[model samples]
Target: MNTSAFFEKRVGWTKYTMLLVLLVISFILDLIISIPTLTTTPKLGGIRGTSSVQVPSSDRIGMERVEIGIGIGASEGCMWYGKDDRQCRYTLSFQPSSEFLHLPPKQNVTKHFPDGQIMATCHINTALQAMVTTSFIFGPFFAGLLPFTMILLPITVFMSIFSAISLLIASGQVAYHLKYSIPSFELQWGINSILPFVVVFLQLVLSIYIGTLRCMMRKKNPPPPDMTDEVRLEERPRDNTLG
Candidate 1:
């Protein structure tokens, strides 16, 4: 049987095409998630008479706002509460604090704070940065392997497991930080932060399915008989006829 015809019948175009499409989507999603601007919120302080400050988006991976300060004081506008008193005007700002930027190909990070005090500490930022890096590296590579299904199967399985583990670790860290961190400020997770896990999982499943299909095709369609064997058989029949 012709190799092309066998592949067309067994593997089909749609299966691999869909796999390629999924891979591309996963790659793009990983890149988007890697950007630090995905989440932003106002950091506020104080129970009564609070002030709010907009935290800047992180420039590099693993960078986050861990501490904020708000000041409440009297302004020129007076509504009159009593004989000698003033209304409050809230002023908001972020205090200098330490941040870890876990860029790729680097392990050690430097810490700095103007006041020599650590306001908050959270390792979730580091874990998330690592997860984003992994996805960024593997997503494109997996997509590239789609044309070579035989090679892709084992690698995809490994990647799937790695990605799942990374997701769990990152998620756990985030949960821990949220639960234990400052009560006045809350960190909100954006869609970009969560999309990569879902995409990686889908890639893993598709890789397995495609790999299985390839294996079945190979089993069902054995290689064509050797030309040399057919020639020898024909020659032997002629020899017997002559003898």
Candidate 2:
């Protein structure tokens, strides 16, 4: 059985099946990365007697109090509240300190003390909405039209490109924050923030492959003859036989 013949016989169902599988996998990965997790290192400062704060996942965006742990002193734990200049303060062992500093988004904030400074790092996980939209909305939309290869192929390719670009921008934003702002913070690519980028790239590759397969199938299987032409040809053969 020739490989091309095998694919041609089933109307390129194999390609469509593979496309669906890729889209599903991509959607899952996109969804997974959208969840808030500890994408960066908890400890931020390197100086002795400096406290290291671990901002919990929940406090990244909301007005909730962020729990902080001190590496030095006998203080058990502290909590940070608010991002405003005066509101950004932490209480360590019931000792209130107003030296807490807020940095730009995706960067770690710092707390000043006489001994040393403590840093709290967190990234804005804004890609969640985009990833979710791409995965749940656009992905399924294209997958549903897979049976119509002529329509599906171009749409898939276009969607794949669009999603890939969007993901790239998101990944770049995360990486920029991780690199320049968060000191001593290490971001795990596969586990933390790089999942969407990888998934989108995979989707793009799959879309291209599906598009190629679609073109090949089209070439192999010619379009059906026009109904009127087919009818005319059939009638001419019958008329000749009768004559």
Give residue 169's error in model 2 in angstroms.
7.6
Q: What is the TM-score of candidate 2?
A: 0.37
The runs of at least 3 residues in candidate 1 whose Cα sits more than 4 Å from the true structure, single-residue gaps closed, are 1-6, 35-148, 182-184, 220-243
Off by over 4 Å in 2: 1-10, 37-144, 147-190, 220-243
Per-residue CA lDDT of candidate 1, range 1-243, in tens? 345545557766666467656655655654443322211211111111111223344575553443322211110111112223223222111221112111123211111111211111112222333343344334323433224544644454455445545544543443343234333224343353355457567666666776677567657743454654565566674444655
- Error in Å for residue 113 of model 2: 19
Error of 1 at 119 (Å): 23
Model 2 superposed RMSD (Cα): 13.5
Q: Which ten residues in a row have the lowest lDDT in candidate 2?
A: 116-125
TM-scores for all predictions: 0.42, 0.37
